[model samples]
Target: MDNLTHSFVGAVLGQAGLKRTTGLAMPALIIGANLPDVDAACFFWLEGTEHLAFRRGITHGPPALVLLPLILAGILWAFDRWQTRRGTRPEARLPVRFGWLYGLAFIGCLSHPALDWLNVYGIRLLEPFSSQWFYGDTLFIIDPWLWALLIGSVGWSWWREKLGGDQRPIARGAIAVMLAYIGVNGAITWLDNATRGTMTEPYPRAYIAAPLPLTFWRREQIAQLEDGRWISSDWKGSDFGYGYANSDQRQCRLPDLTEARRTNSQLDAFLFWSRAPFASRAADGSVILYDARFYDPRARDRFSVALPDVECVELSAG
Candidate 1:
């Protein structure tokens, strides 16, 4: 999920009455929710496809989940003390409680990985312990519908808070609705996975339902056959019994690049992070690498890389 979504979720959680737990609780929640993204700083040093392997890993793992909140709580606690010493503390501000602040921060930090896992980009929940990437395949990376829900809930709750009315109910309602929406989408993905094998002759050896933006009922389907052919299609939930028409099918044979991977750092990182990797030999004799999940001819350069002078033989489908 994007940072805005994470922040809004934190705000919603706080507005749902957690803010009363202690002073600076809202800040702890909102900041902690997005703290796992600290690994994004790797972009400064890591180059080309390397960031993919680095991000959503260690910071989102169990160890960081525990350590990050503790650090954030300490910072907030210090900030409060500093404010008090400077005589700048707000008059109506409630007394800060270290224990409550830590708990809230932990809750917020925990939400980061859980929400991150709900997308197709994948996350390493046990990083440092293991580098395994786990995908939910449940929601699009950026969902406008989800944004709307979170925004509306927070907005409504804020308005009610101004009027001195109980705002928690509306915020809680939004959470319930959001969870239900996610559940429905999960069921849809499960349905696709369960029925995909029987959809046509020669079932796919692997398949994924990549959710699209705005159109929650549809998915960009990617499937690989045992013979190594990759197929892509726009799958609509409305036409369930009738199988989807394949938009494009290509023989994306992956050549043995053990030597190239060792010699090329970018290629090594790309392969390490690529889930459905395939290579196509270019006219210039270079090999263009791509992940089937994000392959789009319109924006080929964005999700693909060209390795010049690397010869990759196109293997025939068995």
Candidate 2:
């Protein structure tokens, strides 16, 4: 999910119990919600580390989402107990306060991965055992429609609260609407998968279809086993009749270079281990490699680059 969505969810969670509970607790909840993204700082020190940054590893994984909140809640619980002993008399009991704080934070963290999984970009929901990616591809990474609905409803709730109107009803209604939208979208996705299966079954090894981004009126279908390679199709209409298939093979093969001086050496190893390796040589004689471990072959650009100077040196030595 985008940062705005994560922060908005955190803000909503903060507003939920903070306005009703002691106002001081809002910061903790918000911080905890946004903490998973703290790994973004790696971009400053680690050049060519965006793939690791976006992989949703330990910090955004299920273990961190579940355990971090409990650890934070424990600390908050201890602190509250000490404050109470010092005659602070906090409004809520220690357990109740910690529960709300942890619950909100956990939800905020979990929301990031859930929204990310909805996009074409994959997420490693079950990490450690398998880095294999699972993609929902129902929404775009920065879906304007989803943002409009979520932000608009959240803004309306804020407006109602400011006007001294009952905001909970609006918030609850918005939540219901959002849930219903998710359900409707899920059903549409299932129907699309079924239709795509039916369309490709007759051809069998000829065509493959997968859900595209943003709108339900389109899908990305491709041809397989063309000229000993797979070819991708353009986004076709929902009815499956408006796109042309690329006769050119889209799948890439490994280069037959004998040296270990490739630009994306590490990435190539990772890709090969993950079983979706492909190599392409550019006009400048630089090789571009890809790993299907992460969906959206476009992201293959994140790998390290081999300079023309190095390539020339190796060629000259040969």
Candidate 3:
């Protein structure tokens, strides 16, 4: 999920009464919600596609989840003490309790991975312990509808808070509605997966119900057939049917480049991060790799990487 969503979620959580637990609680929740993303700074040193293999790995794992909040709590606690020493502490501010601050920070940090897992981009929940990636395949990385629901409810809660009215109920209602919406999306993905085999012949080896923008009920279905071809189709819950298969059967002809994968660092990083990998070969025998979940022809360059001078194996779809 995007940082905006995370921030708003933290604010909403605070508005739902967690803000009363301690001083600086709002800041703790909001910052902690986005804390794991501190790994995003890797772009400074990481080259090419290395970020894919690195981000959302260690920082999102178990140890960092516990450690990150502790660090954040300590910093905020120190800042509060500094304010007190300088006689700048607000008269209305509640006393900062380390326990409550740590607890709120932990809650916020936990929300980061949970939301990150809901997208097709995937996350390494057990990174240091196990480099396995987890995907929710439930929502798009950025969803405007989710943004509207969260922003609107938070806005309402903020207005109510300014008017000296009880804002907790509205904030809690927003959370409840958001959860129900996510549940519906999850069910849509579940139903799409459940009914796949019964509806299609030559059942797919595996498939992902990649959510599309705007039309939340529709999925850009990427399925790997038994013969190794990655096929694209659209499935709309409204119609309960899949659109015709894409004409590009050339995806099945992707050549094996085990040797290139072994020798190429960028290619290695790409494969390590790609969940639905497929490839294309240029006439000169160079390979371009793409993940089926994110293969948009209009923006293929952004999501693909090229490996030069690769041998092409004539893989037959038969």
Candidate 4:
């Protein structure tokens, strides 16, 4: 999930009870919720390292989700206890208050990974022992509709509160809507999978379909298949194209196991954990890497490729 979504969820949780239980603790809770992303800072330190981006790494892992808040809570508690011993009366109960604070913070933080799992990118709910990626494949990385629905509902709730109308119902209703959307999308994806199986040889390898620019029109679906091929279709139209070589022409030798381990280790840990990883060398000698993180084959294009110093195409153009 995106940071905005995580923050919004944190804010929602704060509104639910964290704010009432501990006023200033809300910020701590929110930070804890987003703390898993602290690995993002790695980009500054580990430039050039594979997957070293903050999105994949310890901070985003399950271990961090479980332990970071507890660690933070202990530190806050210890600081408050120290202040109390120094004759700060208000600080005496700070440790006790922080217990609730930490609890709320943990919940807010966990929500991030939970939501992320809904997308094609996987999460390591259990890590250390395994790094297999998993995903529900129901939503796009960025879904305008989801953002609109959630933000709109939250905004409406705020408006209702200002007017002295009950707001909890609105918030609850919004959450229900979000859940319903997830369910409907999941069903649609399942149906899409069923449709995919009906195709004959040169099966579609990757695809993405969602509500398009137009509403009445069915969603647009784009796919890449085994051969150097492409297909685009919609609920309303059937269109296809193939321009590249067969699948065999595109095949290449993969990186060795040692290279795989080294590259995977270097990648954003969260991203590595979220996708099926593959490495190959293109005919032009460029490296091609694939992270099944995003279920779509288009994601396969994300792999790096080396460019030749000079080519026949350049000479022809000259």
TM-score, one value per model: 0.91, 0.67, 0.90, 0.66
Model 1 residue 91 lDDT? 85
Among the numbered candidates, top TM-score falls to 1
lDDT of 3 by residue, 1-318 (tens): 999999999999999999999999999999999999999999899887878889999999999999999999999999999999999999899999999999999999999999999989999999799999999989999999989988999899999989999999999999999999899999998888888723388888878888888788887777887766676675322111112233231332456657767877777888889998876544465556778776653344446677566544434544
Clashing pairs in 1: none
Tell me the spans in candidate 2 whose CA falls farther than 4 Å from its real position: 13-29, 70-96, 197-216, 222-230, 235-252, 255-265, 268-278, 284-286, 291-318
State the local distance difference test value for candidate 2.
0.53
Lowest lDDT 10-residue stretch of candidate 1: 235-244
Model 3 lowest lDDT segment of ten: 235-244
Per-residue CA lDDT of model 4 for 33-145, tens digit only, reads 67777766665665343442334345657778778888776776676667668886473232357668678768877877777777665555555545544566677656777
Query: Regarding TM-score, does 1 or 2 come out ahead?
Result: 1
lDDT of each: 0.82, 0.53, 0.82, 0.55
TM-score of 3: 0.90
What's the ranking of the predictions by TM-score, best on top? 1, 3, 2, 4
lDDT of 2 by residue, 1-318 (tens): 678766665666544434365333554565666667666765676545344534565566777788777776667667777777899856754344666667765666677777767755566776655666766756556655557766877788789888987666665665666667667666666675666543543442444344454664455554433232333445332211112242221323444544543455444334433323333333454544443223332344454233333222111100
